[model samples]
Target chain A: MDMGPHATFIWTAYGLSATVVSALILRAMLDERRQRRALARLEAQGIRRRSDVAQERRG
Target chain B: MLSFATLANPSFFMRLTDRVLPWLAGVWILLLAAGLYMSFFVAPADYQQGETVRIMFIHVPFAWLAMFCYMIIAVSSIGSLIWRHPLADVSAKAAAPIGAAFTLLALVTGSLWGKPMWGAYWVWDARLTSVLVLFFLYLGLIALWESIEDPSRAGRAAAILAIVGVVNIPIIKFSVDWWNTLHQPASVMRAGGPTIHPTILWPLLVMAVAFSLMFLWLHLKAMRAEILRRRVETMMMTRVSSAVALKAAE
Candidate 1:
């Protein structure tokens, strides 16, 4: 809707909030994806989970 | 066999979160959509403040959640220091940046709201100042975590700082009433009831839920990344150890 005189300030605040929040969310998700990909690469080279070793030792 | 101890293991945690993450993501998306719809269109503008009053939907939620997240950090810090929970440090570390970002949003939006109303971009009022201090506290915590080489030691140091910072939360809460200030006193969270009309109150509450869900989604996702990063670190250390051992044998 038309925000009248203070439209600039209003839009700026909303725009900034959207940009920052979106950036933070994107960073978190992308960082997780990056970490997952790296972990997969390591696993491809036979890097096993510490938990797997622990279970093996217990058994 | 979902034992708590096993769940604390990073691999187990990764599996657990991987299952739930989609749901968390879904909920946040839906909530934010509903919140934006209500906040922008459904909620009527304030009689005096006019269109600018719309800023409340975002600013108030950010301010509330910023404080809430700091408390989360403090509690996680305690969990890290006292119980030495394996995931405690991970939770605290993951929360810091998110808290700091929300606090930054709060300060920025609050200033934007302040300008047309207060006729100034900044004020040294108790509420605003205390919240500013909270932002610094968040930054100091993040810096503390990064500066220390050891995670355990960093968590302990940060925990003590967070505990001490608890004193400031009340000051932020009561600052408008405690002193003569340009900031308005609590209308929504007061003793008797919310002074805000239901038309405005409902959308604000919806926006608050959206912000909270957004925070949880980010925190969980970040926690997953941190766990994976730790796994990589441990793997690297193992590789180095084995390399040194092989050299010794040769």
Candidate 2:
């Protein structure tokens, strides 16, 4: 697209926005994966939440 | 109907988000695609600013989201402090980095837009300066959360800071009117409504909605991660306590 004399500024703004937003999405996805993995590992070792343990005992 | 109590439950929140996220993602993607097409192809170049006005398509949304995200944090902080809502601090904590990212984008994009139009890359104007303060507030909240070891303590401390820092929001909004600034006064949002032509306004609105959806999607995912992290912390503490009890029994 012909962005006149200041095309550089226009493209750079869009590029930077895309970069920052993509980074945020990547970080959120990675952090969620890490937490889920840690929770699963702890559960595998029979370490469960107190609420879960209490529910199990009652059942 | 889901009650406030049910919505506040972490497990319920997690499950609900899991079901809602996929749909939200779909809508967000479609709207973003449409917004970009409209911005680049449909919106005409300004007679005065020329094509540089294209930058506003993204810049304005980023600027709006920056304030919007901070407002979310502040409201969540209030919930954390007063009602002691279980999910409130998680909401605030998850929102900090996202809010910071948006604020940084707003500043950088504004600078980029300013250089060609305003003849400088940086300005100490009221609107710009207040926004800078908002960015620092986001950073302070993030640091406060990270510095403390205990989650509850960290949440309380961060909540206080978030609440106190919220005064900056109104200041940022009214800065142009309150003080002479290179930045233009409110156009899209004002007493008479948007001054921009319809061609530019439509794409801007579409992009704003798309950006908001994107924020909501990310915030939900971050909150889920936080809930899991808390669960892990509780389980680890229980294990340690059980081991100590066994050692004492010996």
Candidate 3:
């Protein structure tokens, strides 16, 4: 679509916003993955979440 | 009390968010796609502003969300200080950078829109200055959190700063009306009903919802990551303590 004279301003706003939001989502996803791995490593060493321990006690 | 109890349970939260996250992601995508379509193709150009008016779709929402995100930080700060909710600080910490990013966008977009209309990119006026201050406030809170080594202590300090910085929110909102400024006064939200035509208003409102949902999705993801980071820290601490005990015995 033709955005006329102010197309630059309009497109820039949309482009920059998309970039910022995508970067944040990517960072959050990576961090979540990293943390999950850390938790898994601990679990491998016999450390588990409190809920898991309580479940074991009940079982 | 009941809700707080449920929210405080980490495993429960992880499970709950896990289920809801996909829904949030889906809705955000659907809404954003619709909003963008209406924004560019559906909405007509303004008689005065022309296609530049199209910028309002995202700009207004960013400005609105900037304030809205800060409000979230303030409320989470209250939770941190008063109820001492386990995840309160986590929520507050997760929201800071997101709020800062939105605020920065608001300022930049405001400037871009302004330059085309006002003949200047920025001016030291009430609305503009207050938002700039809001950006600084976000930076200050993030810095406060990082500088403190202990998580609990850092959370408390950042909570206080978040609480104190809330005074800026109102000033930013009312600056256009309260003081003479280059920034245009509120068009959609005002004493009377919205002044803009329905053609533009609908897309702007839809865009607002889309942005808010986007923020919610991001905030939840950030909070999840933070919880994991803390878990990792705790695990590291436990390992260090165990190693020290074994060495001491030797």
| Candidates' RMSD to native | 1.6, 1.0, 1.7
Mind giving the per-residue lDDT tens digits that candidate 2 earns over B1-250? 9899999999999998999999999999999999999999999999888998888988898899999999999999999999999899999999999999999999999999899999999999999999999999999999989999988999999999999999999999999999988999999999988999999999999999999999999999999999999999999999999999999999
Chain A, model 3: TM? 0.80
For candidate 3, write residues B33-148 as lDDT tens digits.
99999998899999998888888888888888889888998999999899988788889999999999998988888888887878888989999999999999999999989899
Task: Score residue B23 of candidate 2 by CA lDDT.
Answer: 100
Lowest lDDT 10-residue stretch of candidate 1 chain A: A43-52
**Per-residue alpha-carbon lDDT of candidate 1 for residues B116-231, written as tens digits (9 for 90 to 100):** 98898899988999999999999999999899998778888988998899888899998999899889999998899999989899989999998898899899899989988888
Q: Higher TM-score: candidate 1 or 2?
A: 2
Best by lDDT: 2
Task: List the candidate numbers ranked by lDDT, top first.
Answer: 2, 1, 3
TM-score of chain B of 1: 0.95
Please report, in order, the local distance difference test score of every candidate based on alpha carbons. 0.89, 0.94, 0.88
Clashing residue pairs found in predicted model 1: none
TM-scores of chain A in all candidate models: 0.85, 0.89, 0.80
- Report candidate 1's fraction of native contacts: 0.69
Give residue B60's lDDT in candidate 1 (0 to 100): 98
Alpha-carbon TM-score of each model against the true structure: 0.95, 0.98, 0.95
CA RMSD (A), model 2 = 1.0
